[model samples]
Target: MTTNGECRTNGTRRPKPLLSRSCSENYEINDVDVPGTPKTPRTSTTPGHEKCTFHHDLELDHNPPTREAMLPEMSRSYRLLLESLGENPDRPGLLKTPERAAKAMLFFTKGYDQSLEEVLNDAIFDEDHDEMVVVKDIEMFSMCEHHLVPFYGKVSIGYLPCGKILGLSKLARIVEIYSRRLQVQERLTKQIAVAVTKAVQPAGVAVVVEGVHMCMVMRGVQKINSKTVTSTMLGVFRDDPKTREEFLNLVHSK
Candidate 1:
């Protein structure tokens, strides 16, 4: 006798037994012997026979928030700090100050997010010109690392090319990168010089900064007109008096 779900093999009907249990719920099924077809036997349960199913196609979704999404919240906290400092955040003049300040700060401190390599990408060119190249009077605004007060300044850079010269704008960019962070003027000047020297492997590098620190003028000494000058001289600039004098004279000339 053939079962309803059984099929014939070699044009002969095969004997198969019908069971009340289904494959989904059954612990086991009996093998049915049939003519011209071999029977498939089921093994008895061993110690660790556990039912398992194979599945295909698994996926994951991941998303991260952007800087723009988080900046507004940070600006709000800064605005609250301003309000706590006894300033009215709702005043007509101050209404947009917080947002503006946040944006300006983002611009000022953008150097932190930029790499020196990326900033000077392809900006360096091979040049046999060994003369001093000076770019002067680049404006800089930074916060004092000590007091977080504003310090505005001018920077002048000069370098003697060994076999490479950087783009004029890149020198200013180097200054901006160091200046945008909270820094001591001395360290900022040295960092700029060191970066330029390393980037171009120049024969010499000199950096000079003249700054008016708000902390000094607004609170400490209160000397409004006093400006601090700091500089770094490397390689030939340190050993050669004529080279150093040329750099200094050009920087202070105007």
Candidate 2:
């Protein structure tokens, strides 16, 4: 990590840590460390310039209510944002908009407040079953870190259990914990796989995310039909072609 809080790898700057300290310490979920430039914090509160501060600004902890308490302050920034748009924020129609938007923004990024342990809640159970377990078509919604627009998707997770299995719903809960934050689909997919691996020490884990990013449709290339797919395969899933093919077949099937 650099002094400015970004990551350094192979003499190149990288993006911020993919996982928070609480979650990362337990799960070690981060896998990719691609090159990127360090972003300098800007005081500008204009649209697209403002973002959720979470730990960087507040040294956020596990308690989400603490983050929730910052809503009034967040709303102040939102009020400035409305002013930056040259709109009448005080008008009755927009009078409550700042705080309302603040609530929504904070809720949208609440994944910053979650840790894998909270999601699991001691849900892992010992089982002699060693067959592949698959959960598919888990709906997910997330913010694009780059453009801050929405990317909605479905995630399919699979793991070959060793001595333990997680509660079925906990898989979707894992998806929720990661997808609720500002993210790239690539990291989100890997994080889910890693979290599962850590929870169960599975023989292998596989995750696939199929996302339609609003950023592509609403801006940039304006490619309305574009969808992004990213996947992460660990352990046997990465090493065994047949096993990987089986997981992919399961994920892609209806």
Candidate 3:
């Protein structure tokens, strides 16, 4: 019988212990001398700039939270909710309902995972122009903390710059960040005005919100067409009646 390191009558050496028959029988194998095509170049590993093969920034970006990581816990909680509602969670029609509901709920309340710092970063700018900057009709949607129902509407913001100004879109984003959370309309208006004041320290900040609460429309008083108006004024806006009046007129105008 042929043994290790032995040659056969056909002029082929016995296969090495680590190699398969596909390896050339006549060539000596060296562990250190691997032979094949060259390796492809590795991707750059710069921080916050890595190349993602799938789901770009879906896993890496954690400012608002990732849906996949929250899915499991949220789905289990939703199933319990179904039981509380006396609904069969295992039925064919409801089997996947928990997952869908979890995803939807997470999306609706994602503001809980975000912070003002992350949203405002790189969005504020210093400028010398000191005029009243107004962003009107900024749409917002929020859940009423009292009833967990939706309240949605538009906001009007006006600010007199002291030495800084926010990006126009950033103002809208600020509204979205706070509006996505469980909130009351009055507090939501004040929070938007406060956020702008804090970010830019403008001479004055004013915010007005007109919302229709689902709790009012869907239940309780069931006032389907009723609207709630709330406002917050700071600095010169609160001190100067003329400034406040102008802001109100601009917001109420078509």
Candidate 4:
């Protein structure tokens, strides 16, 4: 209108007037300072402030936990479990049972932390003698996977080497690798034979395990005197009956 526009200086353009609007009305305005559309403010608390809920709730304490702080909590839980099984946790004989059980369990399952390569490190020797090297009656103790109860007995390993022969103790170490894990006798026997075969590249490898499964003896039929026998044969042992027979005979011998 001329009434408003005429009031401006002759050389200058008149400024636009703002329209009257209610508080409920929303206006479309571009914010050039912002790269894109304007955004509503986030309601979250800032970090590091005492009043910041996220700072208080999400931040972890920097201190490392002490062994003393851990042991009692663990022992209490185990003691509760023993008590739940109808055993007296505070009995004189059972007072240290939790600690003893924890230590024993760690030792029993230590194979999980051990490696076959480390156990057999540099134990292979280059030998010209190609013979059936047998290590027999290796004592083995393992937990049954199904029951988590101990089943233990003996293992016998025999391998005919091509050029490399494992140390006698390495045979026992291989037995220990499978034995330390929760396993079935059949699988353990096969694993030992296979590992020995691969490690030494032997002409043949044979493993026999004789053990009493606690699942069978302690729970199922409860036949205390019964034992389970399993065997695995590889390479020539698998092909030649005579080679297998010799291995069996040697294992059965003293």
Find the candidate with the highest TM-score and give its number: 2
The Cα local distance difference test for each model comes to 0.68, 0.75, 0.70, 0.66
Residue-wise C-alpha lDDT for candidate 3, range 186-254, written one tens digit per residue: 878877876776677665778999999999999999999999999877766776789889989888889
| Model 1 worst lDDT run, 10 consecutive residues | 52-61
Tell me how many residue pairs clash in candidate 2: 0
Name the best candidate (by lDDT).
Answer: 2
* Model 1 agreement with the true structure over 1-254: per-residue lDDT tens digits: 23563324445542221122232231122221111111332222323322311101011021223335556876898789888999988889888887887777767666555556767888989764667899999999998889878899899999877556899889888787778876888878777876786577665678889999999999988999999999877766776789899999998895
List CA RMSD, all candidates: 30.6, 11.3, 27.3, 29.3
Segments in model 4 whose C-alpha atoms lie over 4 Å from true places: 1-77
Task: Estimate TM-scores for all models.
Answer: 0.68, 0.77, 0.72, 0.69
Error of 1 at 110 (Å): 1.3
Candidate 1 has an lDDT of 0.68
Superposed by TM-score, candidate 2 places the C-alpha of residue 241 at a distance from the truth, in angstroms, of 0.5
